[model samples]
Target: MKVMGFAGWSGSGKTTLVEQVISVLTARGYAVSLVKHAHHSFDIDHAGKDSWRHRQAGCREVMVSSGQRWSLTRELRGAPEATLDELLDKLGPCDVVLVEGFKRAEIPKIEVHRAVVTEPLLFPEDGRIVAVATDTEVSTTLPTLDINDPEAVADFVVGYLAL
Candidate 1:
């Protein structure tokens, strides 16, 4: 699969741009998958749900299936956080994998930036950053696209990956 990442500081619109790109990409007949990394703890199951109950009862992994879809939640517990490659191994094949966060990983990435974020550009320090999607005008050798132009960004990503 072609792997691309979206990296930026908090409130920089990475998630929004990724969501838009996914919609455009999917509409264009490409199968896309997303993998997001969260710094803080998060929950995908509610307290009263069977999956939640199974997890609370000390099940290492719980797979909940229905006719349309299924989700597998695994508890890492004290185990070290899994690497990007390890996480990707668990995902089924797709034409592209749009990863959010995992900024330190050595993969091609599009940095979503906003002037209001007031943060230094990740591309300056990270050679893996291939392009940027921003709200403000930027002058750089790499392509700079409008953050709202999801179709343009999606086109760039697809072209870059030759997908």
Candidate 2:
């Protein structure tokens, strides 16, 4: 599978661009998977739920199933957070994987930048950034795409990776 990523500072509209990219790419018959990195602790299970109870009861991992869908939750239990490659192994086959974080990872990615923001561009420090999507006009030599237009970004991505 082709692994691509979107990297940016907080509040840079990375999610918005990523969502549109997913919509556009999937509509064109590409099987896309995503891995999003969160900055803080998060919980998908609610208190008093069966899955929650299982974890609280000292279960290392819990698998819940129903007619609609099945999910597996595993507790790290002091184990360090998994690396990008380790997390990617858990996913099934796909044509592309869109990673929202892990900007430091060694993968080709697009740096999303907002016009009003003052944060510096990440491409200068990262060689893996093949292109950039920005809300304003940038003079960098790297290929630039409009952050507001996902179609153009998708087209650029497809051409860049020959997907």
lDDT of each: 0.94, 0.91
Q: Which runs in model 1 stand beyond 4 Å of their true positions? A: none
TM-score of each: 0.97, 0.94
> Over the stretch 60-101, how does candidate 2's per-residue lDDT look in tens digits?
999999999888888988999989999899998988899998
The number of the candidate with the highest lDDT is 1
**For every candidate, C-alpha RMSD to the true structure in Å:** 0.8, 1.3
Stretches of candidate 2 off by over 4 Å are none
Best by TM-score: 1
Compose the digit string of candidate 1's lDDT tens values, residues 64-154. 9999999999899889999999999888989999999999998899999999998788898899999999989877899998898999999
Scored against the true structure, residue 144 in model 2 reaches a CA lDDT of 92
Model 2 whole-model lDDT (C-alpha atoms): 0.91
Candidate 1 local accuracy as lDDT?
0.94
